[model samples]
Target: MPGIRFSAQDLAATRFTCSRLREVVAGVQVLKDAGARAIHLPWVRQARAALAGVRYELLSQLVPMPARYLPDFLSPMPAATAPSLAAELAALTATAPAAVRAQLERLPRPLPALVADLRRDPAAGLGRLAGEIQAFWTAAVEPHWPRIEHLIDGEILYRARRMATGGPAALFDGLHPKVSWQDDRLTIAQRRRTADLVLEAGRGLVLVPSVFIWPGAAFEADDSRHQPGLVYPPRGVATLWEQGAAAPPQALAALLGRGRAQLLAELAAPASTSELAARTGQSAPNVAHHLAVLRAAGLLARHRTGRTVLYVRTAVAQALVEGGG
Candidate 1:
């Protein structure tokens, strides 16, 4: 996608900040909670763990030198034209280097331009954006292969294969997630187990790539049209960081509006749920329940400052209210 508006230098200054990084971490936690059921948390956990081994390399590839060069290269495209970009990406991938070619091919077939356009307009080209992103990353960034191939190949790719397929076959067995494609409306037993766990945990879901969890899972539309990897979350996570506001009546509205707003106003600083309830004249149980929900949703987080759990609103929560997401 076109880069966000920061200059190369400014972009370089932007390390994935606490706000963004925390969202990812929170999402991971929620996913783990959900995966406890037949959903298979181990698979997702393994995928994330594998990522740690190569995250530095992946980050380097994403945040390259010539600092702003990458973002500047893609800033002007209109969002609506993302599909066209996807088409461009698909064409480019036709000749990607062998090592990266396979990765590029696994992406949903879409235009790179279209994906880049998302930086300008997130919802513009919804259909093939993910594939286009995969293609673009492989083509634009894969050439500068860091010495992290062993991790990517041995860990990331290995875990991804396990998630896509169903077994931990020997590496030489050639059984891999990238090579597995289920087209018959089937469900993996492991995935179901994991999902059960997540629901029981009472949180949102985050899908990660692992030995038994497929990060590339896509779904067809009501009309039964085939959409590639990235089926859930309707819109990719990038949408939360893009221009327009998210679909409203958000996951945390109960704790962010005027009523809750009053409760927050009463607190000079962090306060316990019981304290908030007393000030707001709401029952402690109700207040506590809302607090837990907000914390799980990333709108708020709890920390132990003393003898009580202190609740604090997160920046993302404020941004969402301001229509910045």
Candidate 2:
């Protein structure tokens, strides 16, 4: 079992951010797993076909095992509230040669020639790797990013509410079956490794929510070089790739007309017009039209977060959904 002992300062400094780099890294593991562990994620199966032509052989070799050690430099912590994929690729490209060499050296089966080239001209080596990552993302992730982002955003929202209402203990509770909270310590159960981390005040812990890191949580706390953090599967991930529209109740459909009612029912959680369209198998224009009607009718409300507009059910909408059901 790996446990992190949090100090008062670490608790105070703890924060959450969704990482595009992490998602890409985890996707590598998913691809290597060959859909065994991620059997429930239909998107993973779809991604495999999409990424067949990508030159991901190197990444696949790097992450042969899911729960094993992965090079830390591959997925650094996000530097912004919602870091874009391009920004993350740039971060990888900017990684110091020494750091890249260090991580490459740590690989169980190091590629001697690749390591030599990276150490010789770190910028060029890392630049090529970053380009590969960008290609991988385009083939395997960009298409499904809206749904992925919604899952991550929903998890962050839930964690915020937990922390606000129940403090750290409440938020940590049930984060994962293997995770336990007591005595200001966060313990993560690991299959073949164990460590105790004592966090310092200024260092702080970063809580990252991952959609693909299922079944177990990962902890990274090595010296002062990288911020201590845990990457755990977010809540409600079981339905991440569950297909088909959320069918509206007959009563609600009759009352609002089928298209509008279906849109409202799908808005049980916050979603953008594009996300709604993708999930409900409707066109974006059609979804936007229904959303406008619902908003005008007081059944939906839109909130702007960053560059995207997310629509959520209002109190009346929730009541109607429940009553109609």
Per-residue CA lDDT of model 2 for 289-317, tens digit only, reads: 99998999898877676688878777789
Task: Identify the leading candidate in terms of TM-score.
Answer: 2
RMSD of each: 21.4, 4.2
After TM-score superposition, the amount by which residue 134's alpha carbon in candidate 2 deviates from its true location, in angstroms, is 0.7
lDDT, candidate 1, equals 0.33
lDDT of 2: 0.77
TM-score of model number 1:
0.21
For model 1, the superposed segments whose C-alpha errors exceed 4 Å read: 1-268, 321-325
- Least accurate stretch of 10 residues (summed lDDT) in model 2? 58-67
Assess every candidate by TM-score: 0.21, 0.78
> What are the lDDT scores of the predictions, listed in order?
0.33, 0.77
Runs off by more than 4 Å, candidate 2:
39-41, 110-121, 191-193, 246-304, 307-325
The residue-by-residue lDDT of candidate 1 on 26-63, one tens digit each, is: 23333444443233343344445444433222222322
